[model samples]
Target chain A: MTIRILTEGELRSCVDIDREAMETVASGFRGLGEGRAVLPPILRLDVEDANGEMDVKTAYVPGLDSFALKVSTGFFDNHKLGLPSLSGMMTLISAHTGRVEAVLLDNGYLTDVRTALAGAIAADTLARRDAKVAGIFGTGLQARLQLRALALVRPIERALIWGRDPEKAAACAQEMAASLGIPVEACAEGSAVCAEADILVTTTPARSPILQAEWLRPGQHVTAMGSDAEGKNEVDPQALARAERLVVDRVSQCARLGELHYALEAGLVEETQAVELGDILVGKAEGRCSDEEITFCDLTGTGVQDTAIALFAHCRAQARGLGAAIEA
Target chain B: MTIRILTEGELRSCVDIDREAMETVASGFRGLGEGRAVLPPILRLDVEDANGEMDVKTAYVPGLDSFALKVSTGFFDNHKLGLPSLSGMMTLISAHTGRVEAVLLDNGYLTDVRTALAGAIAADTLARRDAKVAGIFGTGLQARLQLRALALVRPIERALIWGRDPEKAAACAQEMAASLGIPVEACAEGSAVCAEADILVTTTPARSPILQAEWLRPGQHVTAMGSDAEGKNEVDPQALARAERLVVDRVSQCARLGELHYALEAGLVEETQAVELGDILVGKAEGRCSDEEITFCDLTGTGVQDTAIALFAHCRAQARGLGAAIEA
Candidate 1:
């Protein structure tokens, strides 16, 4: 057997967050909800002394030719050494033979794009069709990617960016506006940003709630994407309780490391009450009941997403001969 | 960063179950027991419809320069397709930067060697010093590797072989005797094999107990290398309970997927009663207390072994200029 290795540049040149990719991710979520996917709980290791953490995730979807094993590592103190904190590689294996097929050394670039595609899918399925403003919390790669992703689903013409560093927020807003041809503004007041936007995306790794219930408005859809670990919070428990409908990428994951964990601890939302995004995609659950109802989705990321994206990238790379093939 | 892709042939040439490699694995176990290693619970995925199973394991030792993420896949019916039943690859990451260091596409070759090394380490620590006759219970790759490994620790001049198929057992015995320059006999009776052997290794993936307490003799050390899954067992619970000293590669793993799981469930042993092999290596636990005592070790394998072996293989390959290096 031979295994292909795709570098970051090659992956970027072949794959993008577009309609087809979004549809693939949406199908992954559907597969999970429909019980056609084997996704195990993520394996996480924390090296407190080194300020490092690593998570390994994988999934096998029936009828798919291959599966993916992703190992993502984060060294919180890497910024001090002028290196990015997040990096990882994904290994793809043949489902039929259980042989190594490809390895995507994208340096978490594909993870970012797949995650953004997930955000877009949530917006497409749950947000208001005529949503004009997308509010974002955080001024990082995800903040920019999420806005670009939302525009593909809703008619978002403007964006409001908020961050602890005002200068970073302003700079990100300017860059995004120039690139996406959307009017973007940096907001100092979080509540004001929430009040004006039809959709809000929380992208900060905050331990405490950053988006309070008092700041939420009706007819808004909030996609909280930052809380993928325990002790991480983006939206307040009260805000989640106030939502007319609460959606999650996966019920089991949300109960452990998502916004629903905090809401569950506060006795605000019952585990049975939360809807799964996959169920919504598969027509087993409702998404947004009405345009005037506040909706929240806790996305703790799933192994199926990694599998879908990795398979998609590998197929595309093979078609275009974008990676180097070596002996296995 | 660049990642060197090592093929199975290159890995086979560079790594073997020798004294140095066994020592490396032993030290890894010690690191885990000393709390100097970060090993998360293994992430396992099973596609029941396809008879496919995959496990993702990783560990970070504080002083190690690199860590390893090993993805092992098993497709039980692959022999029907004229293919090996198992295939996998290990990705080595630089601990300080979390960047890709090398990819060992050993295709489970390294896993087999490391597992054998673990068995050898158990025998070296728990078996009697003058153990001469080594007993093995299978005719597979692991069965051969384990006997070869045991010869390194003790003066195993003879091996008693037992298998359901006498022809296969006879063939294996002949091959091992010719290669290792030892007297190997294939015995038709299980109890007779156990009675004549000083060190016994169980290497079959049997669902029920193959070794009974009634057959065990004093000064005998049994290494149960099978029973890595929920329903697989190599020895009877009664046999384990009767052992004077019980040891395991990892306590948590033994409680869930090893022979100790059955023993604990049968009330034959407690989780606290079994000692960790690493603790013994680190001088925290006792190995074989006396020559007249029967001892048993459940070898379920661990991520620390993967890390240690992968790192060792990568370094050796680099020094010898093996494998292909490409941009990642």
Candidate 2:
């Protein structure tokens, strides 16, 4: 019994997830919403030590016959030790046989990619067809991935970047302009960027409201990707309350971990008020009702996304014959 | 961020799982019974395809700062395909950071060893110290491990083996006699071996009773390591009713996936009737009461054992400079 083990580099060489893979994952979202599969509860562990804090989360999605177990650690104090605050590895296992097929040592790269891809999927289904302007808050890895994914899914003419660090925001704009082939400019304030864009993406790890309800324009699609943990909020509760359509990757997950957590806590929304992203993907619910309707997609990430990406990677790796073979 | 990948051969060379490491794991069991640690639920998947039937069970133990995810598949139909079905890997992750620290491609060998060691721990705490005769049922990998573990924890002077295959049982007896320097014989029937032994170990995959109540004697301790899944049983429920005391690895797990599962279902024993094996190890409960008590220890494997062995393997691999290093 030999199980093929694919390492980080090997996986990178073999996996070519372009627009096609993103579409497949989007389809999986629909399957998930229809109850054709099972996405179990996410398992979490919080570790506190002299080196700071780290949260480990594992998600299991049964339908894809695969589960992606990711270990992400945030060592806030690691900067002093000349190490990044975050590091991780994702193991893709066969749900059918429980054989670990690949070890993705991408730190947090895949998380960023899958998360942004989910946002892109939401944009594809919910954003206005001619969505021209994109607003991005926070000049982080997530911000970059969101921009790249949005480019793949929408016709973005320009991007507005806003961050706490003016220099970093400027650098992000310049980098995106060169790498993503888009015209991007750093805004003076978060609200300035939020008000001018047709699509908005919040990637800040903020505890307080950064984007207010008044700043959001009608028909503008907003993706709240940050504020996934408890006590974390990027968008104000008023924004969620005012949105005409409240869509989420997973209702239960969003209620606990996404921006919806705050909305529910503030009595602004209930479970019945929310529609799953999958429902809209499958045309079970309306995405953007009118040109002037406010819309929001709260994505906390799901195990199904992990499973889809893993399956995609596995198939691609096998096709390319990239991984090393080991006898079991 | 670099992660180490340990192959089976490399891991075997690095892991110094002699008596000392086993003793440490034995000591950790005390904390398990005290409720200071948690062994989460095991996830199982059953696949019956052209390749035969495969049962994959993953056990998660959070206290060891790790989880043991093991996969075992039965390839009874693999003869036609010229393949073996019962093969899989165990992944050990660091609970603190959720980093997959090591992957053991042991094909269930480690699980067998850890399970047997756990049985040894139970026998050490529960079995009479001066027991001279040991009886084992089913000639398999688990049976060998159980006998080896029993010898490690008791003063066993001889071993009696029983299996459906007379040739396999005779071979097992000869192997044990040569390796352990103990008097060994293959019994014609299960009752014959059970009646003559001071300590009994059953490691079969039978769905019906293999051991009878009438065969058990006073001052005898029986360790049933089989009957881990739903419809698997080896010892009679009446035997459990006759036992003076019953010990289990985990109360909840035993009630769901061990010999206790049947006993509880039969209404012969309740959850409270069973004591954790860890409790006995920590002296929280009595083991044997005089020389006339019939004791039973239901041995369903736990995730803690996986974590212990994985950690042991990781440390040893690091020390010996084994396994390939890949960038995370």
Candidate 3:
């Protein structure tokens, strides 16, 4: 039997700022919403070694005929040893023949990109079209990707950055301002940024609500990108109560792993209240109703995204002759 | 993050075929029957590009901390491309953080071994105490592995081989006899050797029943190793009726993908009539009620086996310093 092997360098060279990935994922989401494909299943592995903590997850999406299985080890304790906190690889297998088509040593780079792209697509559908200002909380890699992806979908002329680390937030603002060709300022307080921005993006790994409910303005849109796992929250529960519209990637997954978990637990939102993002993408449901209505999109990330990104990466690599081929 | 990369050669050196892999997997079956660990989930990939074929598979057991997601791709048309009909890779990921630890390019060798080990373990429990004669069907790699694994668990004095191709069967008998230090003869008729054998193993890829109900004798133990997917059957459905006891790896999976599928579909047996192989291994169910009763152990293979074998391989490789370490 012969199998095709695509290495990490090849995969890296093949992937870029993948608009194709975003579009493909969006289409996959639409398919999921339309009940055209099966999302294989989610498998979780909890790792407890001498190295702090981490969780490995594999999500199967059948339509792509591929599975994007990610293994990310959290060695937060490794930082004291001068090592990175997380490291992992994503393996893309041919859904048809079960041959591993690609091995990506991305160090979570592709995951970050896909996640950010989802946020961008969500913002494109849920955010007010004429919104001008964007407020981004958290100056992490996710925060950067979210900002860049938001800019791709919205005409954000200015961005307000806030983080626990003021120096890091200032640096993040400067970098975003220079790279995006937009005005960006470091905020002294989270409430100030929340009040000024028309679109608010929360990217922090906070266990409690960081944004206040009273600060939210009508007609504004919010993208909650963090709080994916259990026991994680970043938005005020009241924020969900105030929103006129709520969108999620997967209703069940969002209710369990996304921001909806807390809202549902607190009885702030009912099970039938939230709509899937794909519903909005395919026009099965309303996204933004009026300029004065507040909207929120919660993303927990799905296997469909992984499958889409992998397919896009494979095609892009093949077209550019980016990957090395190995005989099986 | 650093990931370990083990090539075929390195993996081979790291694994202890006799004691580590086979024995550990056997023990895993026992553990599974006792409900000690969770086996990885089974995933199917349907190949539409090449031809209409599906790879049905399950990840193995004993991989609580590190799971080797087993994927097998069936390309029945690969012969036209000068390739084998099946190809796939086993991806091992850290259980702690979900970082992919290694990819073993075994080309289904590991799968064959683990499956054969299951058969061997079954034979250890159900076969006659003084078994002397062995009959094997099929001249494929699985046939070879089954014979080898049987030798590890039994003291066979003579062997008989039968296949669709007389020449292949004769060659298989000759090679196995020389290597195993046992007398082996190629039988002209399929059931000629079955009448006198103490243990019979069927390893064919036949889509219809190849073994008849009358071919078996009293005190004979049958290990049906083929019939792993839907629409594939190697033993006669009536043969299951003859067995006093029928054991399977997993009742649910076996009913769907093993010889039990045919029997159940034919209304020859029901879920209540079949027993799991793990049950026998853990002594929860009886293997052979009496020496004179015919017994059949259907081997459908499970994800628990994959996890067990992969974990054993990884540990062995680490101990022997077999795999190369790559930067993540």
Q: Compose the digit string of candidate 3's lDDT tens values, residues B32-82.
A: 788765554455434455563434343424335676666566777767767
Residue-wise C-alpha lDDT for candidate 2, range A80-128, written one tens digit per residue:
6676677665666555555566666666656666788898898888888
Winner of 2 and 3 under lDDT: 3
lDDT of 1 by residue, B152-199 (tens): 899898998998789999999999999899999999978988999999
DockQ of 3: 0.24
- The prediction achieving the highest lDDT against the true structure is 1
| Full ranking by lDDT | 1, 3, 2
Q: What lDDT is obtained when candidate 1 is compared to the true structure?
A: 0.91
The sequence of per-residue lDDT tens digits that candidate 1 reaches over residues A150-250 is 98888888999999899999999999999889899999988979989999999999999889999988899999999999999988999989999899998
Count of clashes, each model: 0, 1, 19
Q: Write out the backbone clash pairs for model 2.
A: A2-A328
Top-TM-score structure, candidate number: 1
True contacts kept of 2: 0.16
Q: What root-mean-square deviation over C-alphas does model 2 reach?
A: 3.9
Per-prediction share of native contacts kept: 0.67, 0.16, 0.26
Worst 10-residue lDDT window for candidate 2 chain A reads A48-57
**lDDT (0 to 1) per candidate:** 0.91, 0.76, 0.77
The predicted structure with the larger lDDT, 1 or 3, is 1
Q: Could you give the CAPRI-style class of model 2? A: acceptable
lDDT (tens digit, per residue) of candidate 3 on A81-122: 665676665667665555566766676667777889988888
